[model samples]
Target: MNKLTKSVLALAATTLSFGVFADVEREFSETYNFSSNGTVRVENINGNIKLEGWDRDQIQLEYTASADDKDDLERIEVEIDASSSHFSVDVEFKKKSSWFGGWNGSSGEVEFRLKVPHEVVLKMIDSVNGNVAISDVYGDIKAETVNGKVKIENAGSDVSVDTVNGDVKIVMQQFKGDQRIKSESVNGDIEVYLPENEGFRLDAETLNGDLSNDFGIEVEEGKYVGADMEGRYKSGNARLLFDTVNGDIEVRKD
Candidate 1:
């Protein structure tokens, strides 16, 4: 082939290769109509998930598909189920990428963010390898992460958060009725912030770390040789339990 023809073929090959190996990034946003007492449930494999409460009577969600290879990004599905009294948004894979598309170290990740009505009755967020955060939410919050942090802030209801390999932090803006908080972590710290005037009893325990607080509650050594603290504040109507295996437990007055 002539030199000009050789150059043209090389250019075409390069373009084709680029197209085959390009990274993929895409965003999806959706809004679904729903009445009060909505419930959102999420399960994320490897990305952050955030939840925020809003005043509107709808569930709004946005998610991003990111992968080092274009085809790897196509395996994720944002599943949504909206009913008059219940709603759910889930991150699911069309097929498990571990078997089909995980060859040659292709990286894939997805992040989900949602906003729902403040009167939603129940909310559940779960992530395997990424952080989970919720803010300004009402009702009951149940959040968990296996390898990342769980942070719930400015919440106005009961909360239960658990993490195996990361920290857990909860900041309660106020107490609604008889609020209950139960948080646990296996390998990281657990911190809870409570309203100053709220009456509650704390049952904080740690197996390998210190149990601490700024509320001046005395730390009582467990009968089995661990750190356990139990005390009441004022009326002690509310209840809290912070448990950790290899990290500290701290209770702070907000």
Candidate 2:
């Protein structure tokens, strides 16, 4: 064989080898009968989780799992438990055993997209390494993450959000009931937007950050290197509390 031909064959083999071990993905989807006042919970480890409220009286769940190796993809498991009043989705990773009798690290990613009734309550939407987003929901919401952002838009009831390493943003269309709304972050900003005519008591503070408001409430400087805002906006029974350790807090009128 000629040298050029041998070099071409070598290059082709390398390319084929790469193609054999590329990332693999799998998709899963399901629909369930759910009530408008049901509760939904989702937990993820390494990808985004997005939930949107719809007019339908059911819940639709779709997720995609991807990994660099097919074996790793197989090790990732998704668990879903559902009923008429509640639904929960969880992602669990099965440990792989190494030749040395120890656990080998398996890596995979899962992105979940869910749609449910507009009046359902989001009890817990937690993620360890991905973002959590919800929109157009009319019930109470509670979401937290260890290393991702938490964002909610068009929320019609009370909300509570917490994050360790990302921002928290909540935009409410209407503040329902006298329930308290709270948001906290350890290393990212917190921003909340409410209707201009809504009445709420605001108590926002940050340890090493600044506070800004559009409701004409005064922001007081902390003793050290922080700021806080405490007062009532239109003097209502609703209460809002926001705090952060290393980021800014902004309260704006929608």
Candidate 3:
């Protein structure tokens, strides 16, 4: 073939490749409608998930997926289940990308950013690497990650979190609306800062870490090995439960 002819064919191939890449593999948006209450479940493989509470009645979800090959990116899927009082947002990636695409890094990674009403329950889980962040939410919050930090603030309800190797931090203004916090890490630490004169029960224990409490409890057995700490404060109402294996557990008044 002539030089000009060969160049024209190459240009056509490049354009086609780009066109394929630009095409929408899979894209859709869903909104859940409910009246009484709502719950959201989110799971991520190797990305960050952030949730924020809003005033609207609808639950909104958005995602961004990445893959090693263009074709693999098209196979990402999101499932939405809208119930009477609960909803779930699930992300699924193609399993056999290696056999079909023959790419080296066809694994999928998606990051989720969600905004729901303040009265909705939030449950999130991540496999490889993800960080959980919730702000201005009053409902129940439960999140777990393998290798990412967990941070929550301005919450008015109960909270539960578990991580493998990441620090967990919770900041609350007035924890009087039935608080139950259980956070643990084999390598990281747990820190909680709450208002002084809070009224609630405190059950804290640690096997390999030091336990510190500002409730004026005398030290015993080199740790606060107590079943419950109640009537020590007179303001805030909470039910705090903290435990860690290889990290420090701290509970202090603000």
- Scored by lDDT, the top model is 2
TM-score of each: 0.84, 0.89, 0.74
lDDT of 3 by residue, 1-254 (tens): 11111111111222212334453322234455553356677776677888888888876766655555566665555555666566666666655535557544345666777778888777654545878888777778888888988888778688888888888888877774657766767767788887764576666656566677787754344434433222345544477776666677777777
Model 1 lDDT tens row, 1-254: 11111111112222212235576666666677767576767778889998889999888877776766546555545555666667666665544435556634336677888888887765678999999989988878899899999999887778889899999988887777778889989999998887787788888888889888877789988777688899987785678888899999988888
Relative to the true structure, candidate 1 reaches a TM of 0.84
Q: 1-254, model 2: which lDDT tens digit per residue?
A: 11111111112222211235597777777678888999998988899999999999899988878777778877777777787888888888788999999898788888999999999999999999999999998888999999999999988788889999999988887777796789989999998888998788999999999899999999999676888899998967889999899999998988
TM-score of 3: 0.74
lDDT of each: 0.76, 0.85, 0.65
Model 1 residue 200 distance off true place after TM-score fit, in angstroms: 0.9
* Model 2 TM: 0.89
Error of 2 at 68 (Å): 0.7
List the candidate 2 regions with Cα displacement exceeding 4 Å: 1-21
Which lDDT value does model 3 have at 28? 32
| Each candidate's clash count | 0, 0, 4
Tell me which of candidates 1 and 2 scores higher on lDDT.
Answer: 2
